[model samples]
Target: MAGIKQVRNRKLLPDLRKEGHLSKEIVLSTTEKHGVPAGSRLFSHHTLASVRKLSFYHPFSIPEDSLDIILAATYDHSYEHFADKEDLYLQPETRGCETWRRLRNTVGKPPKPKIPLGHPMKRGGITERKSPFSVKLMNSGVHSSQTNPGYSRQPAGGAIFFY
Candidate 1:
């Protein structure tokens, strides 16, 4: 929270780094992926206000139970609002070009890798962090004769099936 004071004073870089109070970033990223659920306490006014102030990028307004439509509207509104504030309307040449460049750079390409976290690796070069390539098993949808549409049930032999 001390860093919030630093940010408010403009002492810290306005650009967001990976570390910090990541709740806003987590919510935004997750909303983009899984969508926001209704009555999410995470979007309560007090929490959202703090997120608005601290977040580097403008957080898009997420609609309850509707992701695509809300995302589109939020995108359009953000573009128009920022365009007006940056005076892209009055000054077409300089202002518009600058705005375009900044926006392009921000959204254009993938960022290069930064330093990895945690201590140096041991002899085998393995760390405690989870690897992306790890193998895993997932539940497959299979139906049993006794089950209904998309319904799963434990069979007599402890096998699960979908109907």
Candidate 2:
């Protein structure tokens, strides 16, 4: 039950430049906990360079026996929503583990069948072709090598133009 801090038009630091993976916005002068019940704001900078240097991962250290956060949402519905809803911060076993790796030594191994198109059925499927038209190039070969009367390519290895 702390006061919220209002931040506006603040510049975010780049990601790669930071040491950790996730770099959330700094909660300046706010008594709010990170990922509080109320939704938090994510910011972006004009330059891609600034974003590249920012961190994308949260730094919360997971206890050796605990799971990691899969989903984080802020909600106001208390009572049932708070009791029945699953906590996004809880990481269940096999959450981040590869499914195939976990099933490696399991029993009742079903024979892997060759999917009609590919191993993953979703990606392999025949689709109707729309265009029956024979492809034709509008431009045949090169136009007259006529150099523009006004402009021409600089002599080979010409002076380098610097910004």
Candidate 3:
């Protein structure tokens, strides 16, 4: 049946006793997943003038019944608040294009094959340059245009034609 103030005061006494003497100001704040409880109160008799005379209170001094209520309310509040925030961040609009772009950039793409200027391969000379595609096509019975005119559908064997 102790009042909130009396309970907090009681909690503070033990901590002060343990320390033997107050030496500094100690701030206490709790962040639970659900949120802070309304019934939970912080009471400190020490003033700023008593900066060297302040001590922290023990959390265990609060009655079990009050602690249970505080924890339940705090857990509920934290869960709701954080869940909403998570939902907001996870929404399609918030994490669609930009996130995808970031991931794509991080993974990177294969580099493009570099074609040198003045190289015979650039001028469609199939005799000197034989690429893997051409070899495969030749192995597959598709004749190169250089070797057979009628069978050549497009530029054969990875040869580039620059007019």
Instruction: Report the number of the highest-lDDT candidate.
Output: 2
Strongest candidate by TM-score = 2
- Segments in model 1 whose C-alpha atoms lie over 4 Å from true places: 1-35, 39-52, 55-94, 99-106, 109-163
Q: List candidate 2 segments past 4 Å from native.
A: 12-67, 70-163
Please write out the lDDT profile of model 1 over residues 107-140, one tens digit for every residue: 2233544547655435775557886445232643
TM-score of each: 0.16, 0.17, 0.13
Go through the candidates in order and give each one's C-alpha lDDT. 0.37, 0.37, 0.36
Q: What C-alpha lDDT, on a 0 to 100 scale, does residue 126 get in candidate 2? A: 59
Pairs in clash, predicted candidate 1 = 142-161, 142-162, 143-162
lDDT for 88 in candidate 3 is 30
- The full ranking of all candidates by lDDT, starting with the best, is 2, 1, 3
Q: Write the per-residue lDDT of candidate 2 for residues 1-163, one digit (tens) a residue.
A: 1232222323333322222344565433334445543333233222334433345644333335323233322223453354434554433334432221121122223355667766554546656665634333455347543343555555786644433
Q: Residue 58 lDDT in model 1?
A: 45
**What is the Cα-based lDDT of residue 69 in candidate 3?**
39
